[model samples]
Target: MQPVDLNPKRKKENPLVWIFEPLERDPEYSRERFFNFQAAYLDGLLYLAVASGEEPWNGLVVCTSHDRQAGLLEAFPVLAPHPVLGKWLYVSQRDPEFETVAHQMVKLARERDPRMGVVPGKRKRSPDVIEMKSSSRKKKSW
Candidate 1:
């Protein structure tokens, strides 16, 4: 979970730098590796993932649950089911509106779009207690 920046010197090495640069401009955003691919999060909720693998999955993966799938589908016609993260949607880089739609997605996340995020679970629960009770099994020992 590190904030990544598009290194101007290595811009040629990353084809998606242009798309990620604008997103990095926001203070609450960061890009990090998730599973085998990279994902971008806004205020701790993941909103997008970058996959440069095979077709269908090789693009921007919108972190969406089934609740808002319909609206997102209507907005981004090129979206499809992600092969890796089944719950999310994939927007192909080959789409003509890739850049435009990706930028819009960043903006939507910035606006705190209800349809754009999954609230992460809190990890502050009390510690579990382990009880060590003694059992009388010596008489049965063979």
Candidate 2:
């Protein structure tokens, strides 16, 4: 039997529910929408991304640093480098064991595996650029 619906707004036909529901249980896990896709974070570090973009690109994305790439590949043999996400790994839904591997990755994330992710570098922005963006939002004094 299907699980009882926790959210009235979420449709029963939505396929992405399986992706978000499990991650929400982790206290440190959070998500933000990046245009058409959802970026999943763990302890503020982006670890997984779920997007239905195109063939080979649409599915679970494992965001890992260069150092952890080899180790992660060893864990999830089905994963490959995403075309747009640069160093991130993409596991397509076409894989026969997609659900199994995705669940395994989530479990590894919950366990706080060192191979799951890396601390992203801070974005560099000049003070003038920041001020310009913020000042534009302020109403001009007549």
Candidate 3:
């Protein structure tokens, strides 16, 4: 095995974050790191996410319901269904219109559009979990 350098390297900032920065305008806007992306929420609903990775993971993921996906696609023609996550939409970082579409997605989220947001994880079933889940307003960790 090759020698491994275990020293922690200072991580670079996620370049995609600029897309959803505008969402901060909302008083209720909050964000938490979800995997390699940052999950943006309004009030308590997760809306937009910025991903920085390879291929499909390196893009902006629009987390919304299937019913609303069609309307969102109509409004933003540049977006396409994420290959791995067909239910939602995605705009690759390399797309020419990536920035514009990202901003629009944020706008929709800021407007509290129904198309944005999806329950993060499993619904709370147990009482203890339910109480804790409601307190933070986040369903659960992925």
CA-RMSD of model 1: 10.5
Minimal lDDT window, size 10, model 2? 11-20
Worst 10 residues of 3 by lDDT: 116-125
| Per-model CA lDDT versus the true structure | 0.72, 0.76, 0.82
- Those runs of model 1 whose alpha carbons end farther than 4 Å from true positions after fitting are 1-14, 119-142
Those runs of model 3 whose alpha carbons end farther than 4 Å from true positions after fitting are 1-11, 122-142
lDDT of 2 by residue, 5-74 (tens): 8899863342553776687988988887644567778898877767765775568888787677888888
lDDT of 1 at 51: 67
What would the TM-scores of all predictions be? 0.66, 0.71, 0.76
Residue pairs with backbone overlap in model 1:
none
Model 1: per-residue Cα lDDT over 27-140, one tens digit each: 988877665457777888988777666786567778889878889888778776677667788778888888788888777777878878775445453333212122333356
Against the correct fold, how does model 3 do in TM-score?
0.76
**Top-scoring candidate (TM-score):** 3
